[model samples]
Target: MNTTEKVQTCLDFIDQRLENQAEQTIRIAELIIEDIKNLTAGYHQAMRNGNLKEHSELVRQTQLNWVNQLHDIILEQSNRDLSGQVIQALQKFVSNLNQTQMQHLHFELPSPVAREYDAQYQYLSQEEIELLMGQQRLFPDNNDSMH
Candidate 1:
């Protein structure tokens, strides 16, 4: 795609993410609200019965459960990184766009060609790695959707 089209694609992806986030926020609020209602009812019932021991135990357990729920929510957090390999394609597109813009602005100089294999700046060779490891023929392509 052309630069403009490529940028639009990335922007569209970002916009969809924002929309999904709004819906996700509402869903989480609904869940927490239900949880809060149940906790409140339990607390009130214990207080009405004048059961100090039961009330205290319920409060402590509620605290622990709430914290565990928070931890689970945090662990399940999502975004572009976990979505797919599109982030890599988007980054590459942006780099190319910047390079093109720099060339048009007459600021970027030609890069020097490497004469020797520089391990420090080496690109990954998937085939070689798998062959050396004597493993499965391929890895799952997370780029399926993007491509």
Candidate 2:
């Protein structure tokens, strides 16, 4: 099959799965909504205590945790229900592509080995550092040397 046909077939498969899982999906959504309501209530109580500045940080952190949990739940569900089927379909799709078509295609799959980086590394190139220093010199009024 052509690329478009293959893609449409995969999408149709996903749509069918979604239809079958509609009830479960709705229940999961309701749970997420309830959690959001609780978070909002806590935020309001914190606001009323007149310690909003301090409490706001805590509220922000809690919201981030909730979002992360929601992401994990969705990923887990997708892996459990769809990963194998999707992998098989994709393998067939790639196998069907002609040599020229395959040469033109590019993919950026995640690699566990690529995750590590030097935290203390400098981000700016030498040219960028020089350009920034030049810009600083142009704004003499705001220069630290004046102080």
Candidate 3:
């Protein structure tokens, strides 16, 4: 394979890995939701039985477990952010290479990455915008930075 094809293969691998990470995160979130429901039920049962100690313990466990899960999800997202930056840079490099080597090289690597980035900016979903808006509300003092 030539340089463009090699880079395209690498990019495809990274994209697949990113997609896997996202799916894992979603699975974690679903698990967390189930845990929350079970924890809530346990708390209610302990309260009905007047087991204050058990109720307190359940509360503590719930808090700690959810916090840990949240941390794990955040770390996963951070990894994706770094990977995304690498992908973005690579896409730019590929675009530049195509420009400078068109005459010398003969290869076509269709730029899905470029369109993916553009699509994000051009057509963000309402839910996504609301999520960002919620974050903004959480950090009202923070000045907005480039996403």
Those runs of model 3 whose alpha carbons end farther than 4 Å from true positions after fitting are 104-147
Identify the superior model by TM-score, candidate 1 or candidate 3. 3
Q: After superposition, how far is residue 26 of candidate 1 from its true place, in Å?
A: 1.7
Q: Give me the runs in candidate 1 sitting further than 4 Å from their true place.
A: 47-58, 64-147
Residue pairs of candidate 3 with colliding backbone atoms: none
lDDT of 3 at 21: 90
Pick by TM-score: which candidate is best? Answer: 3
Candidate 1's TM-score: 0.38
Clashes of each: 0, 0, 0
Candidate 3 — worst ten consecutive residues by lDDT sum? 114-123
Q: TM-scores of the models, in the given order?
A: 0.38, 0.32, 0.64
Task: Judging by TM-score, tell me the better candidate of 2 and 3.
Answer: 3
RMSD of 2: 26.7
Worst 10 residues of 2 by lDDT: 109-118
- Could you give candidate 1's per-residue lDDT for residues 1-147 as a string of tens digits? 986777878767875885686577568767778877877787778778888688778778877876886665565455534543565676677778888887878542232333143434554477887685664435535675477
Q: Ten-residue segment with the worst summed lDDT in candidate 1? A: 108-117
Q: Tell me, by lDDT, which candidate is best.
A: 3
